[model samples]
Target: MQSKNQLVELPLFAEKQVTLVLKREDLLHPFISGNKYRKLKYNLLEANNSGHGTILTFGGAFSNHIEATSFAAKEKGFKSIGIIRGEELVDSWHKNTTLLKAHEDGMKFKFVSRDDYRRKEDSDFLADLTKEFGEFYLVPEGGTNTLAIKGCEEIITEDDKQFNFICSSVGTGGTVSGLINSSFPHQEVLGFSSLKGDFLKKDIDKLTNNIRWNLISDYHFGGYAKISQELIHFINEFKKYTNIPLDPIYTGKMMFGLFDMVRRDTFAKGTKVLAIHTGGLQGIAGMNSVLKKKKLPLLDI
Candidate 1:
């Protein structure tokens, strides 16, 4: 039996001859959704098969990865540990927050200095973490691994609809890289960088063996977790047309860039595009929460 929900087909807006179709992978699960689920599937299974009692990973305060891994590991009967970035905020121990929810549900966490987390490239640094966790299976930050990429590739194959172009927002580049690897011939895949200083093409190349693709860097607004009024206005406008709300973190920037590119005539006449909605939509909860306080007009989607 399938454990998750059905894929959501979110509509797109096209001007001139180009058409867009969004594969809403966000709605795949309620507790922990999107590509996070796909990536963790094999990782958790392997951890269990190896007889590891604990799963260790890393992420930030709003990390979909840490949240997903925590719940998934819980369901799969493994202990979860998140090496969080920075000091825990005051009142942050409560599980109402997603990260804290992980902790509440038996996911253990340890806070580390940002400077120390930045040293992840150092083997000595990882050795320290591994020693602290004690024989845990380590999932990289963002749940990225070769096996994870393979699982995401299956998502690309699920849709047979022919598309001239594909795009998605990139955090660690796992989903976008997998989409490129599994895309049908003649389909060009593009990734929108969600963070500043992120070299997604380079990062994907490191995880992907021989998967060719494109990375569009112009759409991030102001890197990860940043937005502007223009973005808000566009998000509202997009929902007016498509009845789907794009969270500012990922899909919102993607649609913004896609539309801008269309206006700039980057896409030729009659082009068809497929944008994967790799969801981290809990960002919307925080977003809409803030908007409610400001009493801004909400998009009715």
Candidate 2:
């Protein structure tokens, strides 16, 4: 699945003293792109290895993992089950095209109450889900399994680029953890979070066993799935200048924070950096709607 894409570097930071290369995992899969592919590849192989007919996992209403996993499962002749969080009914089940496509791809979605999803870590959760679904392959929320990390770790092993710093978004920390574990002992990794507060940091740290790294606290942009006009504009100008589509939900915040840090001279001269494009491009379908709702200038025309 990974052989279909290529790696391209983005020169950043005033084109002076620092440059960031985007490990373009975004182009890996058209239907379900970016780090989602690497994270699920091994798990899918394991599912096929185990002879399981279906894959079960959890995510939110607009979750990229859920969408990707759904298409991937159906493409490989396995079914999918997405355990969605939140109890409220969305205005329409057809609101999200990606989720709708997943349904067409043979995904069996089970929406749980907000309270039940919060206890997702407990053994009872797995027991209940297993009992409900029978003997199917289980992929945890965000697809942060050991197998996924092992696959995500390949981002670092790709080539011999000795970057001083490596950064990625911290959704489930699978990508960050894998990149850190795959790097040289002295190289540093800075995971920028789109989720607010210290809760996400603690979760990523706990999931990390043998690797130690850094985390920046100032990013988030009002928490996960939250966005600002400034960010939307940034996404627009970013596309205009680079011609690369950045999904606003995750990678946009990372790029925003990264640009801010770069302007501040975060790294010393000649410091090379790398950032992972953990794709969320499906979210772009709503970009035009959002910009128009805010009366922002259009870039598509």
Candidate 3:
């Protein structure tokens, strides 16, 4: 589905002489929202077509992918398995809102050690999972694959071609790659990296040959899932002003970076920018729990 592009009336845009429109992909669904919905679209169809009765995927404690996959699988009549990254979560998974929600959606969890989780794509590791789970369709960590990219490509439509720049949060790179593949040659795609590294550039390059893209490594706020009072403050204030909630993991960071660029006068005076709000808001409750423990300010729900 094509998400609405809402113009942001922030004073910063007027001051910078740049037009900023946010693509409300977050409104795509309450559970399977944003890029997650797009990423899983074709993957689920392929799994059903192949006659798989179960879907298995990988994620960390508060991964949006895990929660989205669980809901999507349940909706499609497929049992779901989430190979969680930390074995410690085995005992405390219920304390995590994301995991608990996934469990409530009928997803079974297999908490493994971080070391073991790293081998998720290894043939031997996958073979062992297949042996244990009895046959299941494997969706890669972050749900980024060929079919997922195909689904993400549909996020951009003819209506979006007017923007000179398209911005999105970079996770496993599938969403950004799809944006790059589908964007017009005249438009530049800027991927704000949620993870701290230039490695995503290489991974994204492998997925698409489009050169009209640049990976912005700043604004990760320490790394994936990591946030600070400053970022939380920005998120809350942005919501207060725009009524658009951004998750700390992905969309929040992307919007933060995009706004920073505007302040720095990165875009030309008349340049139009479209930022993708890839939903990960389900993780806010989980993040708020951590913030509470840290004695930090909580994000406004």
Candidate 4:
């Protein structure tokens, strides 16, 4: 579905003489929202056509991919299995809102240690999972693959060509890669990495040859799934001002970085920027839970 681009009427944009519009992909669906929906569309179709009865994927405890995949599989009549990282959550999974919702949507979880989870792509790991769970369609972590990229390419329609810059939060690199492949030559695509390192550049390069893209690595906060009080305060304030809720992980960091860059005069005056709201709003509750434990400020829902 084509999402509406909502104009963000922030004072910062007015002061900078730049236009910032958010492509509200977050409103795509309650569960399978934003990039997750784009990433999973064709992958689910392939699984159904291939006669697969079960869908298996990997993710962390609060992964949007894991939650979205579970709901989509249930809706499409496929059994879902989540190969979750963090064996420590084997007993505590029910406490996590994301995992609990996925479980309610008919997902069975197989928790593994962080090290074993790192071997998720190894042939031996797949063989072992095959022996246990029987044959299933394997959707890579973050639900990114060739089909996912193909789906994500559809995110940028003819209407998006008016923007001078296209911005998105980078997790598995598939979403940004698709944006790069489909973006206008004159438009620069910027990826705000949710992860700490520059490793995603190589992953994205493998998917697209377009040189109109750059990965910004400065706003990860700490690393994947990491957050701080400043970020929480910004997210809450952003929602208050714009009535748009942002998750602590991907989209919040991307928005924060985008606004900061604007404050630093990174974009020329009269530039039109479209920041994609790749939904991970479902993770906010879980993130708030963590924040409470740390005695930090909470993200307003």
lDDT (C-alpha, whole model) for all candidates: 0.76, 0.79, 0.94, 0.94
**Which 10 consecutive positions of candidate 4 have the poorest summed lDDT?**
288-297
lDDT of 2 at 121: 78
TM-score of candidate 1 relative to the true fold: 0.87
How many Å off is the CA of 190 in candidate 2? 1.0
Off by over 4 Å in 2: 1-15, 158-160, 209-212, 286-301
Off by over 4 Å in 3: none
TM-score of each: 0.87, 0.89, 0.99, 0.99
- The C-alpha RMSD of each candidate to the native structure, in angstroms, is 3.3, 2.8, 0.7, 0.7
The residue-level lDDT of candidate 3 at 222 comes to 88
User: With candidate 1 superimposed using the best TM-score fit, by how many Å does residue 127's alpha carbon deviate from the native?
Assistant: 2.9
Q: Which residue pairs of candidate 2 clash? A: none
Error of 3 at 116 (Å): 0.6
Pairs that collide, model 3 = none
Order candidates by lDDT, high to low. Answer: 4, 3, 2, 1
The worst-scoring run of ten residues by lDDT in candidate 3 lies at: 87-96
TM-score winner between candidates 1 and 3: 3
lDDT per residue as tens, model 4, 10-68 = 89999999999999999998899999999999999999999999999999998999999
Model 2 C-alpha lDDT per residue in residues 166-241, reported as the tens digit of each score: 8888887888888778877668888988788877777777666655578776878888877777887887888787
Candidate 4 off by > 4 Å: none
